[model samples]
Target: MQKDKRTSLTDGMFLSLMKSSLKGISQVILIENAVTGFIILMAITIFSYPLGIITLSSSIIGTLIGKLGGANENNVNSGLYGYNSVLTGIALTLFLTGPSQWFIALVGAALAAVFSAAMMHFMRNTGIPILTFPFIILTWFMLLASYKLKAFQLSPGLVPQDLSHWTLNISGKVDWLEGSFNGIGQIFFLDSTLAGILLFIGVFWAGWKYGLFSILGNAFALLISFVLGGEHSLIILGLYGYNAILTSIAVSIVFKEDHNRFAPISGIIAACVTVPLTASVATWLLPYGLPALTMPFVLSTWLFLGARKVLPRL
Candidate 1:
């Protein structure tokens, strides 16, 4: 009887851990469904097997850290700790090139969880979601560290430039179909066309509402970017669309309360707002050679969410 009880206890614990870890992955896109997480895992796997492994491992590490660290049970169970870790790990891996890339990524993942917890505590009074701020800040700092740290090697793909010497690369027309799909993929730092489509399917798999907002976000951003004379090259690469997609989903569904009748409209406005914010942020970071990352999304979402606290009608 004692052995049987122990086995049952172990099984329960294993299942709980697995579910929490999967929730972490899904939470990357701000969803908490395990099936959605599995589909996203498959999406990344189809792009690069090793990255898929790193993504899952990052989620598990974040989840375990939360559990072992004795964070709030509700927060840990909600997979709050895992999302930033996953992004930080994968971003570091892709942004840095060296023998120590993997080690640094793992370290960054652990640090991301701690940073996330700390940010959550600090931001608790503000009522604004931390969003992906942890990932953005950690990545920027680590990337900058490469200039000083011998062990940290920045990828050749990203280079600092003089803004006065830079010119907009608007050499071609944007492909509407590809841009829409790639927007979703870009949220995970993926540039693969197939991965984007698969990610769209994964988002829709979570809920029709989520999928709808994602499409709305992408479509609005596409039209807005084109109308605003955003660089055609960046549009084609889905750079301008990713932050909008994230902003729409976050404001429209993930954080919307049932009493807020204007959430959908607010989401639309927030999504459109990210377009100019993206351009401004990219230009601001141009001299430093830092990708805007999801800073636009974080800022735009915060703008609307914070305003709603006072405006109430918005």
Candidate 2:
């Protein structure tokens, strides 16, 4: 009897260790993915390149990783949708200044991973509904960095310039049309035309494969924002949509058994809603003398709390 009990205890200890190891693996994967995404974003920004190839490449990488990790088909499919990378890309665009800024990007990525893991833990324990922790953390970090550490500038025009001159290869009539299309598209579509289309495709595909109703929930939220004439432009909306896709993919992989049930849905929603929420909050908070060093931590905490409440419901 004593031997049997010892065996049982050993087995339990092994299981616990394994679980902790798996959690650490997931966190490492998230950080690596974020760093890779930052590198890709920097390449595009500095080299004046289109993001299509990089985006697709990253999706492929994510899908392969999911598959190799014994993720289900749905998880692989969601990873291919490209939402996490989109979040990383957006963060890189906003926060990256030069090669030296890679350290800061790493800091942001580490915090993002912590936020994501804590969110998952909270949702598991508390039965909360969360869908956008990544964006919430990322935006808050950028905002605080901008104000306190001078990590970034508040130039919303940066995206426009990058899209127009560096990436799109537009010139002459093509340039004019592209510029006009982007502007008009932002007013109506919710991002640059290409990004909007990609986001729509990614989200629609995930919804079709998994939860149609949950997808509708996300769509309804966006529609309400649109109808209310929310300040989010098409470009910004596209970014949100892209982030949603990545979040869905990540959740699907991490919570393999529950991929189709609530994980993807919750993750997508959290990612989609976080942008506007953070931006609004940041606007109010920045003027009050928040330090840059604390921004990432604060945002991570809020996201962790919100996710705890939001993820389980989905």
Candidate 3:
């Protein structure tokens, strides 16, 4: 009896740890691979302590609430239930300062979990992946609402940094490879070159194919943005590139199979469209002082995927 009780307790703890790790990595839209999760957790922690604390706290809270709300056990265990919540945590922490409204972050996380579950149910039959829509919607609402409330003001003194310090390529231009690596790191709201390098390594460790598509996305976005004459500094800082990176990867790996001739083509299209779409969305949201968080990726992925049904031949 004693041995059985000890084993049961051990199993429970192990399961809990696995769930937490999955929730952590789900921030990058990857499933519950603990190795990937550990890398992402380390990346965020190294970037900022407050970001780390809120990410972990909101993730755990979201998971518990998801389980209570009867979200699919597999989804909860795999951390799908917590990904949007993690995004919520990161989004709020990235924009808002101080611990005073940490409670708001927790509340937003809980709502994100609920919205995630609802989206999963609604889209279950539509064959549409509800990737991070909850985060996009909730964060947008929070940002717009905050304009009227003093508690949610933008992080004071957080101006965009000048890009004078980045190492330039031979032509004194933004290095595509460097921007590609930074694009991966930018997913977690990191901007440092080392963070990007670590994430590039992490994705390769997760799956070589994922790494490949990520690089493809980044490069395609960089090329297109340059051709389109996007702001030089923002392009180099990778501000205009991260969405395309994620969209390319998602359209290729997450939504379509490699066997589909259109997979690579769709990825390229997603990358190309990301810059313009993000710029358009940013303009629309500028009045609200709300950043267009992941709108470009979400919209681009949807366009590419939805187009497949009518045009099946690409």
Candidate 4:
């Protein structure tokens, strides 16, 4: 019985970790199981301890709340109710600084859980997945409201990189490659190449297709940004590429199962389209200090998926 108890505890912890990792990609559960999920969290934690802890806390809290509210057992166990909370916590942590931010993190995470449930229910009949809309909505409100309170300030380290010293030559090429890796890491608020490497490994361990698409997505965005004469500094900082990476991976790997020829083509197109769209959207929201979050990915995927339903051949 003691051995059985230990096994059960281990299993429960693994499931929770998987749920937490799934926040990085809502449909990761479709590609990999609990073991892969655990590996992904290990990679994320190894990259950023605070991010890992906050993600785990929010996921567990959301899952518990969802279970108590009599949410579908399958949805709860599969992390459908938890991923948005993880994103909310990560978002708050990334943007806010100081001690009060911790308190806000907790409350924000809880509110995210509640909103996620409500959003999921309201959209149930629409047949469209809510995705990270709950996280986006909650984080936007928190960030906008934080401007009113003096306790909140943006992290000093979150500054844009200065690239006036470098010309778009050999060094630029190196920066782009490193930036591509950083782009993957930035999804979890990590800005290190090591973290990106680990994340790539984790995704690859889950399935090669996931890993491949992630790299492809980052590359596609970089190329598109260059052609569009976007600032090389933002690209090197990985600021302009992360959402496109996610958008590409989601449309290709998660929703479309057949690996249809158009699936990857569509993903590439979405990534290219989102780069300009993200920039344009950010321009409009400049007064709010909002960074567009993952709306580029969310909106692009929604458009593609919705269009696919009608176009069929797409």
Each candidate: RMSD: 1.2, 12.7, 4.7, 4.6
Q: Tell me the tens digit of each residue's lDDT in model 3 across 1-314.
A: 99999999999976785566455565454545667776777777887877878877778778888677776777777777778888887887777765546877888888998998888889888767888799999987876566588777667533333344434332346667666666676777777787787777777777888888878888888888788777666676787778987887788877785568778777878878999997788666654567777889989988888887676643
Clashes of 1: 0
Q: All models: lDDT? A: 0.90, 0.38, 0.75, 0.73
Q: Give TM per candidate.
A: 0.97, 0.41, 0.88, 0.84
lDDT of 4 by residue, 88-127 (tens): 8888988889888877887788788799889888977865
Off by over 4 Å in 3: 2-7, 10-14, 157-178, 257-259
Leading candidate by TM-score: 1
Clashes (candidate 4): 0
Clashes of 2: 18
TM-score, model 1 to reference: 0.97
- Between candidates 1 and 3, the one scoring higher on TM-score is 1
Backbone Cα, N, C clashes tallied per candidate:
0, 18, 0, 0
* Best candidate (score: lDDT): 1
